[model samples]
Target chain A: MTALMIINMRNILSVIMLGGIYSLISAILFVVLDAVDVAFTEAAVGAGISTVLFLSAFAITGKHHDLKRRNHFPALLAVLVMGAGLMYSTLDMPAWGDAEAPVHQHVAPRYLEDSYAEVGVPNIVTSVLASYRGFDTLGEVTVVFTALIAVLLLLGAIREDEDQS
Target chain B: MKKNPILRETSHVLIPVILLFALYVQFHGDYGPGGGFQAGVIFASGIILYVLLHGIKKTEKIISLQTTKLLAALGLLIYCAVGVAGMLLGGLFLEYNVLAADPVAGQHWGILFIELGVGITVASVILAVFYAFAKFEK
Candidate 1:
């Protein structure tokens, strides 16, 4: 498995590359699920930009991690328990793409039916996010701006000296 | 690597194509799967590709870090301004119905502007973060 390879690799660069590969595969899986927008986002953000960032960070830090053999039992046990718990929780969920599912019975129908009449956009996703749910999109933009500020502060890139005021 | 003719020539061919694709993804979202977020990441990836090939300093000369930082804030401003504009037009905050003569037209305009704002912020922020990472000295 890609996750296994990524975890086992001592070379940090290889691990980072493998992480990108894992995300790329996940993006493809999204495409298979017909979540094309999500697939595009995952491919670009997860596989593309993040991989470059990882590589840049790798350039700053040295090549490889310490390769000391460590006991994996505790980590393995934790992972198994978490996976089992998650799988057990999914047992109570509705079948995949079931029309009678609570999610389908919710506001999805209204969005699918009336969004075109109201928003006039062929893409219901766009209408839902940008028109019907405009406030959320604004919040998302604010979050992106906040993230930039946080990264700049953390990286010492926030210069306070020079100002035109 | 910058001097290598193959890499240089290939980049010349690819960069514009990448940028064009980003634009397509942005404007075609009404009819397609992509929108602002994906388009922004694609745009940033193009810039990152240029940085990877050409040196960072050279790339920064074209689009400075200060500009990107400003643009990131500008994106959020644009989004808020749209919401405020909607409120001023006799509607609730972020209400697109009052944006134009027709409610549908107003929605279209609102979505377009917000997507543009989202695209700008996402692209600039990602690029700015990459610049930070690149500039950090061990």
Candidate 2:
């Protein structure tokens, strides 16, 4: 519904605002799913900072810009095929929260039961993220660090070079 | 945006609370639903709010670009240093079992410091990103 509304909207600013609302609604959906941590992140990031960033970028780029029309049939077909394939594939998976699901059968049980005793943290998610999977988290943090470097190079550093030239 | 008194006053009131909430989320992750990543983004959003209401020029006076860059690197280094510490302490890389008198305590210490590193890097990197985007305005 909101996606359709956004697609039909012609104003870039309104579109961005509606996208932020979509993010907020998804964050609320995460909350409804009992993923408080994920909801917190989605609300803070997707709803809050990201919206601000997008608005700022839009402002910097231009105001009162027109949407450019382009070829859409190929893209539309590709999206429909991908969507159908994904939906068809999901029909073979186990139901939500099934005990025999691959995700629940693996390390999750161990983390759920023993993480508190082993890691001395009541929150199993944090224990798993920081201790049992420390290497993975280290890699993730490195990725975040690397993203800053990339953005700085493209926007911050390159801009300076052009300014001087 | 800066010219609006309501925006300025509200942000002034809200920024401190947001930062405090971030710290709470960071330290209380062991017992709660939040951790470094969430807390870090929340913290950066506080600074972004300041920049929004007060303008980037004034915001930079308090948190210089160099400071954010340095903090980002420092955070990455802190995480690496913890891993290296594990090695030097007769454990494998990032093995928390050797960091304290007991394995559990070592785990606690290791996770705390590791999350700290993650929080620092995430917050600074986010601020740096906002700065980059804001710079394009003028």
Candidate 3:
């Protein structure tokens, strides 16, 4: 019982500390990649909002585990089968960050070089998003708006009821 | 009514500057790091500050719900119009070069129009969403 308690404490500490550390690192990485917009979003959503949301969820649902007997046989089998197929396919993938790879040689260069001349944006990513691939940005904005609407719908009715009381 | 003239004056004064900056960013996107999305957020932030300091009702008076909704729809329409212009000029949907007689300048104009559309849409939608959330909240 004592060992299990110690292990659980360690796990909780590691989860909190490691999650914070990784989030910080990822935020810096985003900055380094010149994705200030994405970096702002990551810092806001991941570091601030997500941490608070997780804590709130934990408060609503107690820390204690229910210890349900999760039937994992089918899940395990499926994962294993998928893992084997993935491993087989890995042979075809170009090595990570290979400069000579087709991905590096293709239209990506044109987007980077021509983005300024064509789109007139200093930030190539922004140019790609707002100009070159604006349709995708429009779709993404719609998705975010839809999500906001859905959340409002879920919580809005409760506010009205409480006001009536 | 507890009258605070300073906060009201400051925000009212700041709104025009913020909106102007948003316009500059929207148009000047081709040359700088600031673009439609960033400009939209910045513009929305100014309005949000007004809403924060003053009541939602006061903010609503300045930008009505109907107006915001119309602006959001208008932004999308502007984007579609640019696309249609490109198509009519014998280019693909959203193709910039075919937008004008000079293909290169046409691309520039096309991008500028598209960015403006994006900026307007994003700003209005964000403000509208904020309004939807804050309006009914006690």
lDDT of 1 by residue, B30-78 (tens): 9889889989999988998899899898998899889998899888888
Per-residue lDDT, model 2, residue B100, is: 99
- How much does each candidate deviate from the true structure in C-alpha RMSD? 1.9, 2.3, 7.4
In model 2 chain A, which range of ten residues has the least summed lDDT? A156-165
User: What is the per-residue lDDT of model 3 for residues A34-111, given as tens digits with 9 covering 90 to 100?
Assistant: 677677556544654345434433444445443445686997799899999999999998997688888888889999
Please give the TM-score of chain B in predicted model 3: 0.87
Q: What is the lDDT for A92 in model 1?
A: 100
The lDDT values for all models are 0.88, 0.89, 0.67
- Proportion of true inter-chain contacts also present in candidate 2: 0.85
Model 3 misplaced stretches (Cα beyond 4 Å): A1-28, A40-103, A116-122, A144-165, B1-17
Runs with alpha carbons beyond 4 Å of true place in candidate 1: A160-165
The most accurate candidate by TM-score is 1
Q: To one decimal, what is the Cα RMSD in angstroms of model 3 from the true structure?
A: 7.4
Candidate number of the best DockQ: 1
Judged by DockQ cut-offs, the docking class of candidate 1 is high
lDDT per residue, candidate 2, B91-125, as tens digits? 99999989999999999899989999999999999
Model 3 agreement with the true structure over B1-138: per-residue lDDT tens digits? 227888778877997897787677666666665666667766776677677678778877789755776776777778888888888878888787787777667867877777777677777777766665555433
* Ranking 1 against 3 by DockQ, winner: 1
Model 3 steric clash pairs = A120-B30, A121-B30
